[model samples]
Target: MDVEILARIQFAFTIAFHYIYPPLSIGLGLIMVFMEGMYIKTGNKQYEILTRFWLKIFAITFGIGVATGIIMEFEFGTNWAVYSRYVGDIFGSALAAEGLFAFGLESAFLGILLFGWNRVSPKVHFISTIGVFLGSMFSAVWIVVANSWQQTPAGYHIVGEGFNARAEVTDFWAMVFNPSSVDRIIHVWQGAFLAGAFLVLSVHAYYLLKERYVEISKKAFKIALGIATVISLTQLLSGHSSAEVVAENQPAKLAAMEGHYEESGSADLYLFGWVNDETQEVTGLKIPGGLSFMIDQDFEAPVTGLNAFPKEDRPGQVNAVFQFYHIMISIGMFLIGLTLYASYLWWKGRLFEKKWLLKIFAFSVLLPQIANQVGWFAAEMGRQPWIVYGHLRTNEGFSQEVSSNQILFSLILFLVVYAILFLLFIYSVNKKIKHGPYDEAKNPDEFLKYVS
Candidate 1:
């Protein structure tokens, strides 16, 4: 339509496409650390095989992740120059830290971890594995810190006047540990863990179904399942904590998330609902006063509603916000059940024999990706009209110099290029998985392997 909408769509498309790889890379990085560590600890050649196999997959994800990510950074200046200028001081520091501390560190050790498998000492390689994992995680930490600061707007003040004003950091540490950062980071990492584990589980489960690489698949499946079980529970706690923070810091967003329109003594948590904004009512199931209990641990406790906010200041996407939030939560609950059920089967020593469950796990790989995306959509959309939350409205964020035609042209190019990249990524990964890991045993004398 117009330049702003075109700009928003282009950014949204690029970012959404770019998001798939980072969580996959981050999740896959954690799995690599565990698989490599196990190889070092148990002196098992199978663990070594697993590590090498997944390392190749991780490399693919990391390379594409880095490539696709660069576009978004440039888009900031090209499409949203005003927003870039406004948050330049604060945002620049976060990006600089990410480049220096996260990307630099990860790249340094990634070479050792990926290429030094046959060349370096086992202990050194193990250390490299740990380093890569930490570096990837640190990358996520800084990025989330920057985004969370946008959500909560802490540790900063505006300078100058009107359109020329910019945010300046008052306290570096406060900027890093802003009110929502810790909770958001925890939620993000746990979600990333799920994404990675489910992927491993999906592939291994397929191998079991086809009766290929039986032993290797069994071990990998077990490891992934264990990770999935623990993190599924952790997400419940983390999601609760994150929501409470939203309630405290962003009452209007919380209100929109729950489809609560009236200012009242207590709010109900809708398990599934459709919000008809014009009528100011929600239709579907809800737990009476559940929102109050969730936030304050009291059924009668007051919870703020959209009515409390001025009409001009309210989130414009109330229905979308409610649906995304509920969908994310619903998928989360299903994951908890799936993991618990799988754990029960593992405890009974028959997890591998359950082909039906294996089939489900094979498809469930899409769940974490879905949850991560929708959860993000809820958070961002609920903060609607505000690119920098309380400080800057999104309408004021665009590059006034950019025209609709220019954005449309760039958007078309981005879609075409991203489509080609997506297809190539899929093909490369499928080829790797189909080829699988080599079945060679490592010679102890040749490798100097030891159990620690």
Candidate 2:
């Protein structure tokens, strides 16, 4: 395989693995905030116990997320030196802000959040939880800003020439608020929320089924379900808004996403389809002119397609992009339906009675994770040959000094290490879930010592 292909795959694999935890951390952080807040508000020890239980899970995820994330920064310099240098001025500022404002705040409050239960007041501990959650959110903000800039370059100017050329920030805020940044950030946040909420729902659903922590599980499930319900619906809106941004700024990508090949045509929205790249044909169910209506609110409105761009300039893996994009969309729709149905069941007082639904909820945790992963795959792959939109080609961005053999060797090593890390994560989380929340009622003295 070519060095570019190997490098891309290596980076993609690392990022995908690293991505698993941040959403969990962010989502779980919100869950903790609510749990702790309820404990304080109502003097409910169950909420306190729930908060503490999830705090341990949150710590596990945060630790793994941080550990896995570091490698990607190193990879940028090692495998994508040119790309790094080109966007360094922009990325450097964004990353620095993330460290100073996001990671620093999160880490600083983290110790209090984890260990201050006995040492500090409940209110203070609650504040630390909020800080950590906000920190994670702000972290997502800057990172998404940086990535969105690549998708829609802004607030920068070219400097030097040839290999020496790079982008320098002209308007820092403009770069921060790049056209696609806000929409993409919102999309990412909602996705992270779903990941966290579904995990809670899954765990509690399992507990309910097992008749362990029944009351607490019911409370936790309802709380998570509310969040999942609201966020899933909002996600649809965000997804549509983000797609509109894509349509406006990256028509070729939008076209590829739907397997549209005409130079200019009303594109159909496929429910699910197989794209034949060679013949420029798609086979499967589709709503006629659905994409056209989505973009222009007119069924006859023409949207630019892959043929509108030069062959080399458009995405190479059209079918893959379409598949990933559709998968994400399909999952989003499913989540919306699931959450709504569960919410209705709760309202009807039949939520816990349905063992089958509980079983479904138990396994549904994977849906959001899958959606988050493939959504990123679609977005990044749709960008294709370009590492920085129209400004830089991915082929031109990678380190010339790196060899395919070196990338392959490192990639294999990463697979082994990450596999072990993943297994450890599952083991740790599974153990915690099985042990369940601490019974504060049974340990009144310890609970009093902390609260008092």
Predicted model with the maximum TM-score: 2
**lDDT of candidate 2 at residue 407, scale 0 to 100:** 99
Evaluate all candidate structures by whole-model CA lDDT and list the values in order: 0.89, 0.93
Among all windows of 10 consecutive residues in model 1, the one with the lowest summed lDDT is 443-452
Once superposed on the true structure, which residue ranges of model 1 sit more than 4 Å away at CA? 439-452
Predicted structure 1, TM vs. truth = 0.96
- Per-residue accuracy of model 1 over 73-129 as CA lDDT, tens digit each: 999999998899898988899989999999898889989988898899999998998
Q: Which regions of candidate 2 deviate over 4 angstroms?
A: 439-452
lDDT of 2 by residue, 370-448 (tens): 9999999999999988999998999999999999999999999999999999999999999998877754344856554
Give the Å shift of residue 355 in candidate 1: 0.7
Which residue pairs in candidate 2 have backbone atoms (N, alpha carbon, C) closer than 3 angstroms, thus clashing?
Answer: none
The Cα error of candidate 2 at residue 405, in Å, is 1.3
